[model samples]
Target: MIRRPDSLKTFLQAGALAGLCALALLQAPKQAIAGPSGVAGTALFQQFPLLYQGVLVEGMGGAFTAVADDSNAPFYNPAGLDNIQSSSFQILNISADISYPSLYPTLYNGVSGAGNNNQNYINAFSSVAGQSLYARVGDYSNYTTHDFAIGLLSNNQMLGVANASPTTTNLGSLAALSDSGVVISGAYGFFNHHLQVGGTLMGLYQMFENIPSLSKTQASALSSTLSDNLSYGFGLVGNLGAIYHFDLPLNPTLGASILNVGTANFGNAGSLPQLINAGVGIDPDIGFGRLLADIDYVDVTNYLYYTGDSLWLHTRFGVQYQFPEILTVSAGLYEGYPTFGVGIDLWAVEVNASYYTEEASPVPGLNPDHIVSLQVAFGWM
Candidate 1:
């Protein structure tokens, strides 16, 4: 058991700070946050973008075998770090995801007797298009997320990934976006007890461009205006997990982690933030991390809670094969898109790529969308 230090006051302060960080994380360009960005609207609506979706899951095809290779392992499965044999190192993870959301307003509207001119239908399209700008009020812009991450894991903490952009809410000050970053994650494990727990600390900043509101005549012009600033708040995400090594010839291992159990900020929204992700793997013999095949349930992005009555939940299935001399494969499904990808490690470089095809098009009359994606990963171990 981890002992509690004397002051309850100190604990509260740290908790408060973490909550604020959570809030800052959800803040970003409005409509630009749909799908994986989280739903837009209300405090809860904006809270979705803060979800991590477990990035490393991509390489392993959603399989977390070593658990320690990812710095964010604690956020996904706390028990992951328990398997780590190394002391400290810096790791960089960068993935670019592109998504084109389709609109079936005509079908829904026609069936519901709400014509194309229906206020409800228009609002839906306008909502998705104007989301991030709507909340911020003036930055009327939309683009898929271009993500970048840099991390360092040492002794007990994982650091990097600054989420300073105002995504869910309209902070109005661009600089506040810089203040919110996540880092310094720590873990505690009773390896013998088979129980391990980990936690993360977050910093928050918020700001936005005055995009303009419905009531303003010159709201369009406001998009050109920009502002920035900082605020202090806190919240936290945690992992509670255990690994059981069965007494068998193959010695299969069972493991589970309840992630985001620790609550963090939700911008001004109340928090009930918790994520539970689990995985299991068996090893013939453990060498360096290993060449194994595993599959898992993982989130590609957060589902934003739009209006009090509307919510979007986004998640996917990840299947992967590892430790093979040939190419490794990964397949996934999200929203209405089906994706297949591949990876290969040669010499000292890793090359990866994926393509997507939509279940149906959004043009109301045309065929569903057909899209493709390409990506590559490189590193030196």
Candidate 2:
């Protein structure tokens, strides 16, 4: 049964989440490392850090800049907060992602004695080199009403890549990163709701550790703990966004945003580069269900660097269909890789799953890493 709660209860729920976020940001454990975090492993890819990437948004090929209408609005494009019709609060949201297609088989073979049985060792090592393997876990919660939103988000990931050069004595490189933060956002509508402009401010606590080069002998003799090499930092970031709705067929909406304006600097560690993204979303009034389609050009500034010689890696396209209050399905292309996702909602509980591939090497189609993600959430609307 659905029983509407009083405003006081809603406010209390929001406050609890707020307190938790504040505590997380202020009470991070201190680390006493001398080297800067991510100094080694991150040399492979020059991409920026995304403090919060909602599962639903990523499931849709990360094309939510123009279609950010849900709890993810505050992180994607705060201007979409104006689309909320009523108050909503999320009590719990957790998600995890891991590389798929079973890298385990080959990894196990290499670890066991079977890999060295013949020239198979060379083949296996060659295949694994330069390939990125990763796992991630995250939790998020938020409260939103009308044109205002606030949320807490945390994400942790471990990424590794094997060394391919013949001159290097290192076995591989590994990096662990964590980000926890609070985000507050606000927006205002103009021209009778035809346009919306918004801004977001985020306070973050981050920690990172990287092992640039390590040999098997050194690994066997290692004595350092996960915290021994860890480095910590803090940052304040901002985002600005605007959306314009056209009064034509399909109800087209054009959106643009600048994330981490002027870059998000974390002292002693590193910084997340600024990105400008633009996209368009359309909602067609069809019978029996809701349909949304989006096309986006993300990180426009890096187009020349990422796609000048290789395949275009900045385009995203997605489409989703929702069946009333029960199920939702989505599909799209993320940087030329296919992605699919599904969601089921029951009462106040929701479950979502997605499958996609990420290009780890400089060029697309060279080194693809298959990944799967799952999420569970509890909320009140």
Angstrom error at residue 228, model 2: 4.1
> On residues 1-381, what C-alpha lDDT tens digit does candidate 1 reach at each position?
223333564455345434433443343232234332211222322322233323335433344522333444544554455555444332233333332332234223432443323343334333333221101111101111111112422111111111122122221111112122444455444434233444444342322211212211122232333322122334443444444443355444554444444434445323324333344555555553344434343331232332112111233344555554646675654333455677665634445555543222112212323333333333442
Q: Which segments of model 1 are wrong by more than 4 Å?
A: 1-56, 59-69, 86-92, 100-182, 186-197, 204-219, 222-239, 248-253, 266-272, 279-316, 324-328, 332-338, 344-380
TM-score of 1: 0.48
Off by over 4 Å in 2: 1-48, 104-127, 165-168, 221-228, 303-311
Question: Clashes per prediction?
Answer: 53, 0
Per-residue lDDT tens digits of candidate 2, residues 278-349? 789997788889998898887655422444344347778888988987799999888789889999888588
lDDT of 1: 0.35
Best by TM-score: 2
Q: Worst ten-residue run, lDDT, model 2?
A: 27-36
Cα displacement (Å) at residue 244, model 2? 0.9
Which 10 consecutive residues of model 1 have the lowest summed lDDT?
134-143
